[model samples]
Target: MSNTVVNSAGAGLVRAVPALVGAAGFALVYLVSGSISSAFASSPAPQPNVSGEETRAWLIENATASAVQAVLMLVSVAFLALFVGAVAAITRSADGPARRWAIAAGTAAVASMIISAVLSLLVGGLAAGLTPDAVVALRTANFIAGGTAHVALFGLFALAASRIPGMSRPVRIFAIVVAVIAVGSLASLAIYYASILILAGRLLGMVWCVFAAISLARRLKQFPPA
Candidate 1:
């Protein structure tokens, strides 16, 4: 029983650490980016319309913050890889469909995180030095990648978790709720181009991580030590 507790603790860490790191990254993005936008723009704060030179200046001025954000995102994703392992470990006791969905969800999420980190890093480096058109192009890449894959994959994860007969009802039900939110998030992005919706989705996604981690930890507690 002690062994089970210890291993469950480890699995909990595996899930929680990445979500925490990722949360920190998002917080930094909001703080750093929001400040930069306000600093560079006039009243009304339509930052998306701010000039490329201003954007470049902010990137250069806050180079360290930009660097930190990139590092935090990368760190988050790295631990996210461990979270994948945790999910896989849990799936060993789950049915075939649950296992398959879990793997697919993990793969998609890992891919999204990698893409988000790499593109954002590249844009941060290049946007500050490039032409206006070039800056626009870079920003476009930054905007477009995650809607189809990232949140959708999370919805898929929710479905898989709900199907896992081993988990408790509240856990499964919450998974389904989160899946619905994920779908709404995607629809908001697709139909209205609402960036705030995306933000809400991601924020809720982290919350889901916390709850799912707890659920998975409980499941892991039932595992016998090898």
Candidate 2:
């Protein structure tokens, strides 16, 4: 029993690592980007009429911060992918279909991360020195890419959680609902008030991370020692 407890704890810690890292990275990005956006929102500069404009303002305010956030986002995605993979490996017996979904979801997340990273580099560079028009174009591109990637991550997380053996179905369903909100918000980013939707999605995402951490810890408690 002691061995089982120890093994479970180790496994849980390993499984929880990705979610924890992702949550931390997301918080960093949200806080830094949010601060930047709030500063710009108070500025006299004309707001860019694009999706995630407020968030983009923060990225434009500081090139280094933008780069850092982009990298952090990528790292977060990698961890999320790992979390999904771990879930699939651990819960193959409960639902094979869910496991496959988890794998595919992880793949989508990784792809989105890669795309976002490249776009961030391009946009961050352009924002460093450019005319208003050029900045608008770069900002538009960043919004589209970032929004899409975020939606993908949320969707995958929801799907994977639903399939995991020990997770409550209600929690899984809530995750799915959050994913839908995220995807909807992303789709509406071009609209004026869509940022609110995106913001809501991010809030839901944070909640999901908490849930994931708890679920993973519980799973770890059940593992046999290696």
Candidate 1 lDDT tens digits, 1-226: 9999888688655644543444344334433554554444333221444676766666556555555555566665565556555656655655577867877886777678668657667766766567876766565555555444576676667667557656678767777777777756666545655556566666566566666666655655443332
Worst 10 residues of 2 by lDDT: 37-46
Q: By lDDT, who's the top model here? A: 2
- TM-score versus the correct structure, for each prediction: 0.71, 0.68
RMSD of 2: 4.8
Off by over 4 Å in 1: 1-54, 146-148, 188-193, 221-226
**Residue pairs in candidate 2 whose N, alpha carbon or C atoms collide under 3 angstroms:** 8-220
Give lDDT per model, in order: 0.60, 0.61
Model 1 lDDT on a 0 to 1 scale: 0.60
Native-referenced Cα lDDT, model 2:
0.61
